[model samples]
Target chain A: MTVKELAEKMNLKIFCGETNLDRTIEGCYVSDLLSDVMGNAKSGMAWITLQTHQNVAAIASLKDLSCIILVKGFEPEEDTLQHAVEEEIPVLGTSQQTFETAGQVYQLIC
Target chain B: MVFEYPVQGGDFTNAGTVSSKVKKMMRQLGVDAGVIKRTIVALYEAEVNIVAHAYKGVITVQLDSDKIYIKLDDEGPGIPDINQAMQRGYSTASPEVREMGFGAGMGLPNIKANSDVLEVHSVVGKGTTVEITNNF
Candidate 1:
């Protein structure tokens, strides 16, 4: 499914990078650790994390992930949103915590 | 081609800038996707190590047809036991750094997993140098 589809299905908020919401989601990786995401996340996966920093956006771009889904109603920091805008990698949000969000995302995409 | 970028210790904001640039370069050069991914992962880990541990550092990237060689030389309190540092879950990062989702002791292991060759040299009071090479 594409990012747009997943957002619609899961009621995720698109904080930035709306232009690239059409990007396809190949899978999902749920991790709060930066190194874990960096080491294990695959390209085209939707990254679910509590990390709201600009470094999260940087890792999403470097790893070529489809989008970042902030869990538990967390919003991206200002600079994080700015970087997401610049890189065109969607920074998404949801009110649900990591576990619920990850389960739902897996069901939708898998 | 060779490219060098400077890294400031504790500069978390700009940690992955160099790796981003190098990823773009590799993409433009039509490097294999898998090769590019591995190189970026390894390079990024090394780059963040400098920002997290060293006082300052320089990252040198040498791209060739067959392989990419990256060397990170830093000035700081160097690792006293390279072997111990290489083990998973061994980190000396400050609490502040850990709060940012790093220092889980996976940096060097991640680097080793992504790169074909990894070399580490350090002196306790002096500094550390990490060399990573990945064949394309």
Candidate 2:
């Protein structure tokens, strides 16, 4: 499923990178630790994290992650949005907590 | 090709800039996707280590046909125990750095896991230098 489809299915808000909503989703990873995601998260995965920093977007872009899902009603910082838009990776948001949101994304993609 | 990038400690705003630039260079050089991914992970970890711990540092990357070599030399309060630092959960990062979701003590381990060869050198009250090699 594309990120756009998954977002609709899970009710994720599109914060930025609207141009990249069509990117295909290969898997999902839930983690707030940047190094954990950097070391382990695979390309094309939708990274679910509470981190709203600019480095999160840099890591997502460097790892070629399909998109980022900011959990628990967290919002991206201004720099975060800038990097996401620059990298063409979607920064998605949801009021759902990490576990629930990850579970839902896993169900849809896996 | 050899490239150098300077890293400033406590500069979270610019973390990963070097890694991104190196990733782009590898892409343009037509390095394999798998190699590029591993290299980015290792390189970014090293870059962040410098930013989170060092006063000043320089990352020198050497790209050759067989492998890519990266050396990060930093001036800081060097790791007293390299073995302990290599452990997954050990970290000496300040609280401020931890709040940024870094200093989880995974940086060195990540570099080890992703790179084919890794070596670290440090002296207390002096600095640390990490050498990583990822084969293409």
Candidate 3:
């Protein structure tokens, strides 16, 4: 699935990287733990997490993830947004709960 | 080939700035993508630990043709059990840190996975030192 589709599925607001919406995704990992996500997540996948921190962006950058979706309508911190912008990463926010968002993303990818 | 950064624990906002800079430098230097990815991942994990758990600290990076050496030292509450801390999913971070998507007990483990050599030394109630070397 592409990021644009995800935004539509979750009814989220995109804060950055609109040009890459057509980018294809292979898998999804739902975790608030930066380490496990970084250590195990496959590249070019969408990452769903409730935790909103700059470290999330750092991990996303290292892992080369396609995007970061903040579930449950949680807003990102200033640092998180700034890092995402600087890295040209696509960070999105959703009003759906973690479970629902994961299920939606799973259906799209799987 | 040598880079050093002062890691401030004052704000979680700046935790990954040092590692980010190092990552940019690697890109400019045209280092191998795989090597740069590994180094930055390990460096960022260590930097986050220092800021979240340490009172204050510094991150030093030493790079050469063969390896990248990163050293982090912080004057915060030290780890009491190195073995326990090394275990994956064994985190002692507070809920606040966990809310920030960290403290999943994967910092040290991730560092170990990304770097070839990792040595940790912590004096309980005093400070902690983490040294990691990534072979390119």
* lDDT (Cα, tens digit) per residue for candidate 1, span B20-93: 99999999999999999999999999999999999999999999998999999999999999999999999999
Model 3 CA deviation exceeding 4 Å by range: A9-11
The sequence of per-residue lDDT tens digits that candidate 1 reaches over residues A1-110 is 99999999999998988889899999999888899999999999999999899899999999999999999889999999988898889999999988999999988988
Best by DockQ: 1
lDDT of 1 at B8: 99
Candidate order (DockQ): 1, 2, 3
Candidate 3 chain A: 10-residue stretch with minimal lDDT: A17-26
lDDT of 3 by residue, A1-110 (tens): 78888788768789776877777777888987777787788778889988887777767776778899998888878888888887767898888899998998887779
Ten-residue segment with the worst summed lDDT in candidate 3 chain B?
B7-16
Interface RMSD of each: 0.5, 0.6, 1.8
Ranking of all candidate structures by their lDDT, best first: 1, 2, 3
Q: Record all residue pairs in model 3 with backbone atoms less than 3 Å apart, i.e. clashing.
A: none
Shift of residue B33 alpha carbon in model 1, Å: 0.9
Runs of candidate 1 with Cα error greater than 4 angstroms are: none
True-vs-predicted CA distance for residue B79, candidate 1, Å: 0.4
